[model samples]
Target: MGFPSISKFLFGPLVPVLRIEGIITPNTTNSIGNKLRKINTSRTEGLAVVLDSRGGSTGQCQTIRNQLLQFSKDNNIPLYCFAENFATHGAYYILSAGNTIYVNPTSIVGNASEPQADIDFSQFLLKNQIESRIIASNPLVNEYRFNWAIKDSEKDKKFIQEITDRISKLILGDIQVSRGKNLKVNEELLTKEYTGKQAINNGLADQFGTYEAILAEKFPLAKLDHTSLTQFSFISSYQWNSRFGKAIPLFLLLSLFSLKVFIKYTLIIQSYLLVSSQEEGQEKEKKVQH
Candidate 1:
C-alpha cells in the first residue's frame, strides 16, 4: 500500500481522490466502482475524481459514467471531477457524469472523434516491401488483418458510420442532460476540441481549477485524525491490484518453500522404504541359501 492509501484509511475528513487515468477497460471501471462503493462519505465532505486520459473503450466508459451518476445520486453528495491533462472521447463522457467538473488552463476537455474501423498500414508495408494475405469466410473477420490493399466496402463503411453516430449521440445526450442550459450544444462545438478555459466558458466545465484547489476550498478543516487506526482505504480494483502486485512475490516464495519441503520428505521416505526392502530381500536370499 502507498502513503495515499494509508492516509485515506485513517478516517480523516479527507477528500477521496479517485484517479481515472490510463485506458478505460473493464479493470478500470471495476476499480472506480470499488472506490465509489467503499467510500465512507459520512466522514468526508465529497468525492473528487481526477481524470487524465486520452480516451478508451466506449462501452467501458459508459459503464463508468453510469456508475458515477448513480453513486452521486445515492449518496446525495457532490462528486467533483477535474480534467488534469487530456479528457477526451470516452474520458470526457465519464467526466460529464460528475456533479461538477473543473479543469486547468491547458487541460484538453473534449475530442468527440468517432470510432473508425480502418487503419492505414500502406506506408509501412510499402517501405518494408511486404505483401500480406488474409483468408476468412466472413469479410468482417478479414478487417482485423493487415491488408493495406483491401479497401472497405460501402456496406462496411456505412455500418461503421452508423455505430459512430450512435455513440456520439449517446455521449452528447448525456452531457446535454447533465449540463442542461449551461452547455450550448451545437454541431461545431461537439465536433471540435476545447481547452480548459474554453470548456469553462462553454459550460462543459463548471470552473477552471485543480483538484487540490477545490479540495482545500470545499473541505478546509479536513486534517489528520490520529485517534482511530482501524479504518481502511476505499476498496477499488486499483487498490486490490496494488496489494496483489506486491503479494505475488511473497506467495510464490511460500509456494516454493512448501514444494521444497515436500520433495525433501518424499525423497527421505523413498530412501527408507528402499533400504527396508533391500534388508528383507537379503534375509530371504540367506534363508534360500541355508
Candidate 2:
C-alpha cells in the first residue's frame, strides 16, 4: 500500500482539507456539497477550508456557507478557514462561517458589498454592428436582458437598487452572525477590501497563518488529506484553455489529426473485413462446386 494508505490504516482517517478555489457557481456548491456529505465525521477530527476566490453567484455562496456551517455544527468539529490570495464578495461570506479564519499577511479579505449588476453590452454590440433582439412575452423582461438599453424608468432603478441592497444585507447579516463579537469593524469598513494584516486588525480575520502552519498547530498528530471536488483532469483542461488561449488552434489541429487517424484505421479495418467476407463467400462457392 502507498504511504497515505498505510498511514491511514495505522492512524485512522486524516484531517480532510477541502479547497474552494475559483468562482462560486452552482457547480461549486454541488461539488462541495457532495464532498461534505462524504466526509467520515466519526473518524474526522477537524475540517479545514482553503478559500481563494474573487466571489461569484450570491445564492451559491450562501448555500455553500450554510452547508459548511451545518456540517461543523452537526459533527461538532472545529472548522477552520485559510484564505489565500483573495476571498472577497461572496467568497468572504463563506469564509465568515469558519470558527477561526486565518489569512496570509498579504491575503486580500472582505468586500461584503452588493452584487455588481450585469454589464450593459448594448453599446459594444451597437459599435460592432450587432443587433440583438429579445423576444419576451413581457416588454419589461427586455430590460433584464444583457443587450437591452438601460431602462429610463424610476421603478426599474428602484427595483435594481432593492435587489443589490437586499443581497448586501444578507451577506453582511451572515458575516455579523458568524463573526459575532470578534467583528470590530462597522458595516462600511466590512464592505471594503483589506490585506490579511489589516483584516486581523479589523477583526475580519482571526490570525496570520498558512494552511501548513494551521494544520501543524491545530492537528499535530493528524495527517493532512487535501480534497477537491474538481478532478485534476478537468482542472488541467480548464487551466489550459484559460492560460494558453493561443494554443487552442494547436489543440484543435492535434484533435483533427487524431480523428483522421481514427477514421483511416476504421476504413482499413472495414476494408479488411469486407475482403475477408468476399473471400469466405468465394470459398463457400468453391466448396459447393467441389
Best by TM-score: 2
Candidate 1 residue lDDT tens string, 1-290: 56644444443454567788877789998887777766665655677778899778888888988887787787676888889998998898888877889999999988655555457676677689976677678867636443456555677566667878887887787778888888865745865679998888888888888877777777664532222212443444554565467668988999999999999999999999999999999999999999
**lDDT of all the models against the reference?**
0.74, 0.81
Candidate 2 lDDT over residue span 1-290, tens digit each: 55434433334445778889997899999988899887766556788999999899998988999999899998788899999999999999989999999999999999989676566666777788877656778877635533345423666667777778888987898899889999999888899999999999889999989888878777665557686422121223443445457657987999999999999999999999999999999999999999
In candidate 2, stretches whose alpha carbon ends up further than 4 angstroms from where it belongs are 1-10, 124-137, 142-154, 228-290
List pairs with backbone clashes in candidate 2.
none
* Candidate 1 local lDDT, residue 41: 55
| RMSD, every candidate, angstroms | 15.2, 16.6
Give all TM-scores, in the order shown. Answer: 0.65, 0.70
Report the Cα lDDT for candidate 1: 0.74
